[model samples]
Target: MRFLLAIICCKLLRLALRLLGRGGTALPGQVALRICPDMLSRLSRGVRVAVVTGTNGKTTTCRMLEKMLRDAGEDCFANRSGSNLERGITADFVSNADIFGRPRRRLAVIECDEAAFRRVCGELAPAVCVVTNVFRDQLDRYGEVTHTLGAIREGLDRAAHATVCLNADCSLTASLAADAPDRVRFFGVDAPLGGAAAVSDAPRCIFCGAQYEYDYHTFAHLGGFRCPKCGYSRTEPDVAVVSVGALTSEGSAAEVRIDGELFDVAVGLPGGYNLYNAAAALSAATALGVERRSAVRSLAHMESGFGRMERFEIGGTRITMVLVKNPAGCDRAIDYLRSLSGECTAVFCLNDNAADGTDVSWIWDAGFERLFDAGGAELRLIVSGERADDMRLRLKYAGADEGDIRVLRSQDELLEAVTSAGGEVCILPTYTAMLPLRAALAARCGRKEFWK
Candidate 1:
């Protein structure tokens, strides 16, 4: 009865979402239960489930994984819109399915939120689990990075059988790798050019209390390193990304080596980090017996979803929207922008809500110094959010000048900040803050899906 009511509610809520011109993510999970009362029981029949959960990169990583599975000739059912919570996931299964509500797929790939991972994993036993990385996100909602990490450990414990795909780049994630030793497969990059910097990542050895040292620093709190005190370092990947293709408008290409064999491939996303992400996804698919070239071609054409490193055009300006929910994600966005040739206009939107976590202190951890420190063709630093002043202050300390930075409280003011910049708007926003920012950009730039 509960599940049935949940389904009915989903219908009503979905209409509301459509009317309001927003995504149906806020719909209660009970609606999912109402529609697919026996979702767990039904999944138990023969379907293999894989859950990807982390503070960052879960959506793109999961979407990439979905393409890998589909290329392997598997019927795929997934949360296609980045709805990774209980209610959102329930809606996914309930809304897109046949009346019987039975999934007709060989694989069910669900992107689980850091908070909802354990609940979803308990309800659907996944055979494979992937942890992209753990970064400080939503200091108010999550309190600390440790909380999200703990949730993942608990979720993994409930799974009947699982293979964990982990990023060797992140120290926080590498620490959690110990829980499942033999089952864990690690993937990462060699140090970038110049051999590495003096800055290190190992705050405390995840294995022993001894401080660890890094061979190189990839970005904020990510890299290949091992414990000097303990000896827990990044194990070599069974599958590794040898080279990344250009992150051009046409897409990307790469070379991946599996088991001492090389496979030249093309990937359709930007950034070197995405190379690592694609490698992780494909590596997981290989474990399921998928061929290399087919999966490579499929992923190369995989469409970029809205707001997750997605690109669009507004007037003459090329609008690139990046969802920066944490420090690591923000760092990567900065890195990508720095590499580009055109003048960069940044819209920094922050919000203090249950969804976005009121504590904006994590901005301090973000390497904003790298941005203001440069001060090149980048113009008009626009900062807007419920906590706009805080964001501005942080940037100020990072050496951003007061004259060049704009602080805005209202939505329209926020939009004006970017319009005033007179170049490509590189919009970077937090979790809940993105919806309104997207809407504003769409309205100003005349984008329908974004505005409505």
Candidate 2:
């Protein structure tokens, strides 16, 4: 009776919120959970589930995994709005089910928050679990990088039977396989990427306090990492990108060797980070028994999601929005902006909302200096959001000219500046700031809301 009531109430609340022009993905689930404490566990009883959680790339990994399942004639539902907490995931599961609390789709791909990973994973008992990578993120909320890793480890401790897909290149993520050695499937890049690496979130070994040695770095702290004192090293990935032939502003082309066979793969998303995401998705798909050929085919045409390198055109301007929450992610987004061809305007939006970590100090750790140094003809900078002044000051310290940096206070002013900008526009926004900017862009372009 409790389960039935929770589902009915959740559905009704979701309907009402949609009618009222709001995205109520999490609130309804929160209310439902209050009514039925075990509502998520109960509803997810008979379903085949794969939960993806980590510091970044959860949504993009879920997107590619969902496409793999759907393309192979399987019906699946996912939390597509980036509402990855316990409440939002519960809401998604409830809304996809019938009134009697039975899922219409037998399969699900869930993107989960790292902080909520332990509780949600224990409830779902997923058949497969994927951890993309971990970095220093939301220090105000999650404490430290080790705490985030411990949360994932605790979650995996509950689902002992699940197959784990991990990034072999990430020392933090690869360390999860220590306990469940036999059940882990590793994925990473095998070839060396040419360029300087970003500031590593994990410079010292988690197991041994000694500094890690890297044979080659793909980006950030991810690469062929080995702890000097403990002798902990990267395991050979079961799914590996043997070489990267082309990585442009449009997409990435690479050769992936999976299960002893090499296949050429193309990912529609841009950036070296996305190469890891593709490998993670493919590893999860294979763990779930999807054909490797079919899964690899889906990678060639995967579409970018909202605020993850999503592109739009309005009023003779092209806008690309990439969500950045932490130093590692911000640095990657800035690197992507540096890869653009013609003259472009770069907009950095920072918000101190509860969703985006209240502490705005992480901006100073990002590689804004590199972006400023790589400036080209007509390259401009615009700072907007609730903390636009803070971002402007940070850019100034990174060698950006105060005269060249324009600060726009409101969303309307930012939109107007974007529409009137004379070149391609690239936007870097924290989580909360991306929401309003996405809505305003959708309204102007007559596109559907991302959650729907």
Best by lDDT: 2
Residue 238 C-alpha lDDT in model 1: 64
Question: Which candidate wins on TM-score?
Answer: 2
List the pairs of residues colliding in candidate 2. Answer: none
lDDT of 2 by residue, 211-272 (tens): 99988998788899998899999999999998998888788999998878899999888887
In order, candidate lDDTs are 0.71, 0.89
Candidate 1: 10-residue stretch with minimal lDDT: 193-202
Q: Positional deviation of 329 in candidate 1, in angstroms?
A: 1.5
**TM-score of candidate 2 relative to the true fold:** 0.97
Q: Ten consecutive residues with minimal summed lDDT in candidate 2? A: 191-200
lDDT of 1 at 354: 72
For candidate 2, the lDDT comes to: 0.89
**Which portions of model 1 show Cα errors greater than 4 Å?**
1-22, 25-28, 32-45, 175-177, 193-202, 244-253, 374-376, 416-422, 440-452
Residue 24, model 1, lDDT: 65
Clash pairs for candidate 1: 3-33, 3-34, 4-34, 6-30, 6-31, 6-34, 7-34, 7-35, 29-87, 245-253
